[model samples]
Target: MPQTNDPFLEIRPYHDEEVPAAIERLVSDDEFISAILKYRFPKLSGSFRWLFKPLLKQYLRAKWSKIKTVRDVQMNVASYMQSMIKNTSEGFTTSGLEKLDPNQSYLFVSNHRDIAMDPAMVNWCLHTHGFDTVRIAIGDNLLKKPCATELMKLNKSFIVKRSVKGPREMMKALGQLSAYIKHSIDEKQSVWIAQKEGRAKDGNDKTDPAILKMFYVEGRREKIPFAEYIASLRIVPVTISYENDPCDAAKANELYRKQEDGAYEKGEFEDIESIVQGIVGQKRRIHVAFGDVIGNEFETPDALAVEIDRQIYKNYHLFPSNYIAAGEDHASITDTDRVLFDSKISSLPEGVAQIVKSMYAMPTAKKSDFPIKQ
Candidate 1:
């Protein structure tokens, strides 16, 4: 943990000066090392841990010896990101990035799809375009393991205390989070948070008004007008579209089971599995669209949420798969697109396949209902 008197020390990412110690902690963490071994050499990790664990630890220590700063860690992550993109994606593209001021730190509220890839793709785009990466907002539920917390914070992520019980505690957590976000913006550091608490597993992206309300918790306490306080944050709505979601089938199955069982329970490590799958799975093609920074005209969180949703829906890049699943005719649709879409659908059971198709079709359906702003 960061040893400091800072109020947000418990939730905020580690500072540059703290990077070396954090790295050392991670290097020394037996669970972290074992996790890596299980991931990279799954078969050998169980039966030959005596032989592989020490070697892996030595390799990690040597590999991270020179990484003394947060930027160095990010640069290393960037290299891996580049390799991942090259191997797992057909192509990556972006729009509306030119409109953002490089020097101004904006609060980027993005549609969540993949647990790990959404903010990562946003960070990659900003990093490659000479803009500073945003401090990501990650829920505490995702940081159940100490290693997970270390990894996330090292990557410029702040914790959102989602599991805090009781109304008063939840409010306090939200207030602290809101203050941290404002403080980050005031310090000219950008932030990226999901529009809601979790990924849109069913593929429908909607901004929850509660999230917007949470943003104003601190502002409300300070007696700041909602609109003016919102404007000050330079809130931007971002849309990320994937031609192929690596976890679509898994997501669909989960959703379907929930529908059948009336509730769903996640395995202890299911989220971790999803994160790894999202990182390594083929995405076909991906597009990230940065939207216009919102103005101060909206008077309430609900209204602000509507506008954010509007931008996300408008800016979402519709792929041929989306159109095909929606049963819509489009000039961009091709024979190969049909074959690939069909193959994905055919691999699942009929019920789950329908859910998967509906998931892909949702963006198209939502976009059609919400027309673009003039």
Candidate 2:
């Protein structure tokens, strides 16, 4: 059953005849799905279509396409990602792949800005470079469906279990996550992870030291640091930026919730809503900037965190919107090597201004700043 907030989630794949039998009953009976879809996809729907006019059955088949192997899943995800970049970017440019050594494995960490496009853009970069690319670190909270589950796993996404209830449980999960991440990298493959758990809502992209420390709690508990374990894997910073975010409303709600409730509860509904917003929301020309590869062998997580932020800022691609926002917000601009702010803005049309502004507004030098400038 779909939650009242989003009727779209409730509309799973179904045959044509089954529409009246399976899907239509919801719109006729629920009212919420009817009201929301009518509001959102009005182009595809008609007045009476809500009840008896019927929607196309193709969308159902689209979700359940086909997935039998990990390879199939990987290509599907890559191309699905490629389609978004090809379709969304008015003009896209990438730099710094030559800085990455394909022969070596890297622990790729990046700033988290846009939820939907970060991993997709990262994969696009690696694909274009001919590397097998990365196994991404995704939160279990985002795996809301079978397709999402298979897609991430196919693309080498390991889940960080967010459901642990106790400190002891949390410690165990951290150790397991550490081992899995190290194993993936030691095999000469790279892994992509946001510096934080979710998209840095509100455009703040700072690295969380706690996440860095989680990489070694197993050794800490045993009276020895996991430097040996960490040394075996290479770490790199990737900076990903979207020309615009498709989910600002969701990001804004998160900022509001943190201010009001002291925390945000990303319930199943919020996850579904974010995913919906990720796909259907309007996004203009997205760009993912690649940062330099780094050595993950570190003395401490704090040191690693500091270095991560440095590398992230080093690779940040500034545009006109960021310059303008920084000027307006009185935010300090420290890095100005890539492109001049005014010139960057001059490159965009009015339609792309909102996106450029959002990217510019991102928190500098943090994982919350979705530079994906890992």
Q: Which candidate comes out best when scored by lDDT? A: 1
Model 2 off-target regions past 4 Å? 1-67, 144-147, 218-228, 260-268, 280-282, 328-359, 362-374
lDDT of 2 by residue, 140-166 (tens): 777665545533454556677887789
Model 1, runs deviating above 4 Å: 1-3
Across residues 1-374, which tens digit of lDDT does each residue of candidate 1 receive?
45667899889998988888888888888898888888887777365876787888789889999998888989999999999999999999999999999999999999999999999999999999999988999999999988899999999999999899999999989999999999999999999999999999999999999999999998999999999999999999999999999999999999999989988899999999999999999999999999999989999999999999999999999999999999999999999999999999998999899999999999988998778777
Top model number, TM-score: 1
- Global lDDT of each candidate: 0.94, 0.61
Candidate 2: C-alpha lDDT: 0.61
Every model's Cα RMSD, please? 1.1, 9.6
